[model samples]
Target: MGSTEEERPEGLLGWCLVANVARETLHGDSGLDLQHGTKHFSADALLWIPPIPWDPGHWRWPAVGRHRGNSRRYINMVVRAEDLENFRVKGVYSEALVRSLNGHRHDPAAPRTLQNPWSREQAQSWADRWNQPREPVRIDGRSHPLLSVPNPPPAELRVNGETLHLAHYGTRGAHYSRNPPPTEQP
Candidate 1:
């Protein structure tokens, strides 16, 4: 769906963690099945956990705990193609509900640098935090949950700093193209 009025989509639109979560610390005591299945989630992939924050926009990207508890590295949340419809319909959250998701994208406790505000060590641990594309995903009609979810095993994504598409990943750490991108000639 990376088309623009029948044209192609332009701009580096991917996803970002608009809010920070403290699920491990807050719900560590609770017996919640927080561990996303490995088959479902790749190392440094994304996710769309429940108890969502109220937003006019669907819950987009959330930093997945790569090191778990360490909060250093993370991936984005993935969702089913069917679920996107449910999120945009939800909006407005109470302050108490949103408090669980309060914090800086990076640790505000540390000093701010022009590039990576955190110190070198801090930055290294949370390196994936900086992997975000410069732009946010543009809502075209509606975004399918599968397209939005992290670790999209059933699908793959492509971003050319101007467009993104969903398709089979012919290669790992590859580039972006139209969904169902042309297969690599292995």
Candidate 2:
């Protein structure tokens, strides 16, 4: 199957949230399972997740909540402009029918608490300002434009006994392994 008009990101940048599925499934018969619905893009097409500051006191956008009592980590990756597909700005963090399971905690009295910080308009403007199509940076005299989230969670996290590194498709920061610091971890 091919991507529909709604599945296209148009133009956006930030992180891509990829489900932990078999490579074949992601590229073959079964496509991506997004918050909106199941949608198919190119094998390289990414599901854009806007970069909001990590609030230690508030719920994180892509919280690594538990699954069967173990930490459930999704593949948070960065991509060059050419690799992007479409953006799912609304309910981007919801899992299936569950709304914003990975977003801000619900508070009915304060309905804004449940909303994502960036609106679609804001995201588009951000993309325009920060994600303009630029030539790849040359590193060590070679083009290495890929850059991952600075200070990502440890690559040592285990999922089903397999070492699961949440960040991919880019270079890790100098403080990558030392982060979440000590205070950030619950």
Candidate 3:
């Protein structure tokens, strides 16, 4: 027997719909003036709606510019099945708002060119790394060892009079701190 809706894996169609609803709701009343781009449901939530895909079929070549057209872009938003249901119940969106999304489901007979690159685990790992807080490099003269000196001093060093902190010095890139380093002793 086919899996029930609860057991069936959530499809990309659902995420795309939720994202559209979120963008419209936020843009209309939130006063945040968010541009037409990816929108996160919450600061702590891993879910987000990616930017709307560009339909190359409608645009001329040079007008397309830097955005290379691809079918994969259509299904890039990853979301949990339960989250979609919860958002619906919480009045984050209405069923009527996304009713048309049902019409856009991919046909089974068509070749599957738009596979999701990330599994749930992979998406969680990426979100964890992206959201991990870095310890700000000490520049307040509290006598902590400097993580590493910036190779080429960061622009903030000159503009804001601050020092850069390398979270994983000699490995990862620099992150800036507003506090300046302690003045050199004679």
Candidate of highest lDDT:
2
TM-score for all models, in order of appearance: 0.18, 0.29, 0.24
> What is residue 81's positional error in candidate 3, in angstroms?
22
Model 1, residue 78: displacement in angstroms? 9.5
Per-residue lDDT over 74-161 for candidate 1, one digit per residue giving the tens place of the 0 to 100 score = 4444332211111111121322212222323333342221111223244333334333322122223232422333333323334345
Error of 1 at 119 (Å): 33
Deviating ranges (above 4 Å) for candidate 2:
1-51, 55-83, 86-98, 101-113, 129-131, 142-186
- Give candidates' CA RMSD values in order: 18.1, 17.4, 14.2
In candidate 3, how many Å is residue 95 off? 14
What would the per-residue lDDT of candidate 2 be over residues 1-186, giving only the tens digit for each residue? Answer: 665446545432212232221123221332243222112222433344434455332222332222322223333333223334333334343332122332445455643232344555666665554433332222223333343222333444443454433332232221222123245666
Q: Candidate 2, TM-score vs. the true structure?
A: 0.29
What TM-score would you give candidate 1 relative to the actual structure? 0.18
What value of lDDT does candidate 1 attain over all alpha carbons?
0.30
Q: How does residue 128 of candidate 2 score in lDDT?
A: 54
Candidate lDDT (C-alpha), each? 0.30, 0.34, 0.30
